[model samples]
Target: MRLILLGPPGCGKGTQAKLLSRRLDLEHIGTGDLLRAAIRNTTPVGARARPFVDTGNLVPDDLVNELVAERFQRTDRPSRFVMDGYPRTLAQAHAFEQVLAQWKLPVESVILMNVSDAEITRRVTGRWSCPTPNCKATYHVENNPPRVAGVCDECGGRLIQRADDNVDTVRARLKVYHNDTSGLIPYYRQRGLLSEVEGSGSIEQIYASILGILQPQGG
Candidate 1:
């Protein structure tokens, strides 16, 4: 099963993808993680993508598509994979279709994890992360606070909220998500591959909903 998980920031797309990948034995491919790995390795595509990523700008569609294509062309690529973040815009979606066609990989399901903006704000604003470079553990003030306030349980490092996780920054991200990524909802729906799942629930609840949608298709 080739699956796509779509959602706004703080919508738990990554968490759900990880769960689904483990349960279904599929590769969990996150575009952000892939870009970071490429940049760390200094690949040709990474060299082109580094500037944009470092400057907090969106990487060009062609460069992102190239990264996706490279992943698909790998000899060890998994037959089943769950894509957490890619095709964020309509143009990227179309470019991704071309890549899929070229690779002969068809998407079996696209899950849209739907959550309200208010809920997104609440979830994102509470997020805090460890300061240690290697121990990037995360905590939430409300949902999963550390034993000691502002301290990382694993590394004993101070926990600080990321600049992008601030309420104002989260709002800006929400606006961009609505402007750029929402179109893909309709794009996938028209193809009869989209499944809408309520996202404002427990992790297991949301994962159960996603599984219910995909199990019928032999996930």
Candidate 2:
């Protein structure tokens, strides 16, 4: 059940990873979450990564690889896992392969959630999040607006759009994604481990599609 879920920003990779991990009883290993935890815990790797993360720049490949390598080497690492956000570049992908080889943990599949740029822009730019530290409820300006304008329904906290979710930032992120991460599609496809899933449908529908691909025939 080991898998790598790949997609551009706002393509629902996080949501799908959570769903798949819960349904199959596998650990969901999201790189963003991992980095945040490390930073919060002040791990050595996190110390090295903080400068770049604070500056809104991509963490160097070496630092990211080190972080991932450390995670994979954890004594409590899950036997089965879903990787959500590592390997954002071809170099990272190669580094990840090396890590997996060293760890003797071969990936079973790489799921790419395909979505158009326009749709992604719409989804990401409309997103807003609660400002309260403990209550981070999310809403969209259109699809799932908060009960009251600019306010979180659950805690009455002000809703703020993340700077990274702005149109300009999202476009920049998408550019990087297409230029770098997209190459992994062909890389994995050539190895016969790539599976494409439509990312625009209902969450349940998309989850079902992923399950269909991962499940054994007629199982």
Candidate 3:
């Protein structure tokens, strides 16, 4: 089913998106990956998008909206896609609504992974990343450590703390998430499309919680 998985950074949106995509047979679309792929493929849009992305800011609305438009237009497209990181702001959400209406599609669900600020800080600040450019596989110092200490199991790359994964930055992100996303909750709820599931359990349990919310009405 078409879904928007919302959460603060490190609230497990990516993991839940993967699970939901597999179970529901929907494409898992992440905005960061979309921009990076566009840049890698050297689309004209990518050339224009690089500077905005390099600064860790949101991509310009025109560029990102066009990309999402392109994505939703592909043939053999599933009826549903789980978007992990698009439509992050009110502008993007408004743009997305226009695009979806033009395409005669409506979002099926807006899913939020509810987590407390303290838990977010605990999970995010403990993350370590592989040094390889664009390889974002993360390890937690306690929950999901590497086979060997301070080394990536996949590529043997050195693991470093992301510049934005520090306590201060994560706290700032949570503040923004709460402040910005609070309104969207009411926006989606009015449409009868919002479903929030606790995301702090085991992966399977969290996935099941989301799946129960998303199952088709009669299926």
Candidate 4:
């Protein structure tokens, strides 16, 4: 079940990835977590990524590509995995292709979660998170609000909306996402491995759709 999940910010890629990984018994490889672990372990790649990460700048495509390569090249590398938040651009996708070829771990499917920009804005802007270092619980205004408004039930910490989750920032992120994926989506489609799933439905509904695609009538 080697797979890649792609979507704009706030489209629930992470949620879907977790669900699919659990149900399919596949390791979930998320780039953000990958970078964080690399940096925490102070690996050579982490050292190079720290500056950009510290400054809130996007890591170079080559460096991110290397991170993915490093993981796949490991002797105990994941044999079945779901990749999320990776190969974000065409260049990264090509780099990943080379790594997959070298490792003989061709991806079976690439699922693109499609949601409107307006829906993304509403989704992101409605999120609030507990800022306590130990209790970083998140909540969505409509989907899962706290018992008391603006208060964390577990820690009683005042919930704060991350700057990146603001409407303007989310819109900007969607724009960048569209630009990067413009070619990436087509590349996968041409390879006959792309599957588009509507991302506006409930999490279970979306997960069911993905399962249906992965496990068709006789597949």
In the range 75-156, model 4's lDDT, one tens digit per residue, is 8889899999888999999999899999889999999999999999988899999999999999989989999999998999
Whichever of 2 and 3 has more TM-score, that candidate is: 2
lDDT of 3: 0.82
lDDT of 2 at 3: 95
Q: Candidate 4: minimum summed lDDT over ten consecutive residues — where?
A: 162-171
Q: Which candidate order results from sorting by TM-score in descending order?
A: 4, 2, 1, 3
What's the lDDT for all of these models? Answer: 0.88, 0.88, 0.82, 0.91
For 66-148, candidate 1 gives per-residue lDDT tens digits of 98877777787667899988778888889878878877888889999999999999998888999899999999889999999
Cα lDDT of model 3 by residue, 1-219, tens digit: 678998777888898899778877888988778788778887777778888888888777689987777666667444688989777776778888887887777898898888889988998888898979767678999899999988998888999997888989988888887777777777887889888889888888888888788774624
**Which candidate leads the pack in lDDT?**
4
What is the overall TM-score of model 1 with all chains considered together?
Answer: 0.86
Higher-lDDT candidate of 1 and 4:
4
Query: Is 2 or 3 the stronger prediction by lDDT?
Result: 2
How high a TM-score does candidate 2 get? 0.86
Angstrom error of the Cα, residue 87, model 1: value is 1.5
Candidate 2 lDDT (Cα, whole model)? 0.88
Pairs clashing within candidate 1? none
TM-score, candidate number 3 = 0.81
Alpha carbon deviation, residue 19, candidate 1 (Å):
1.4
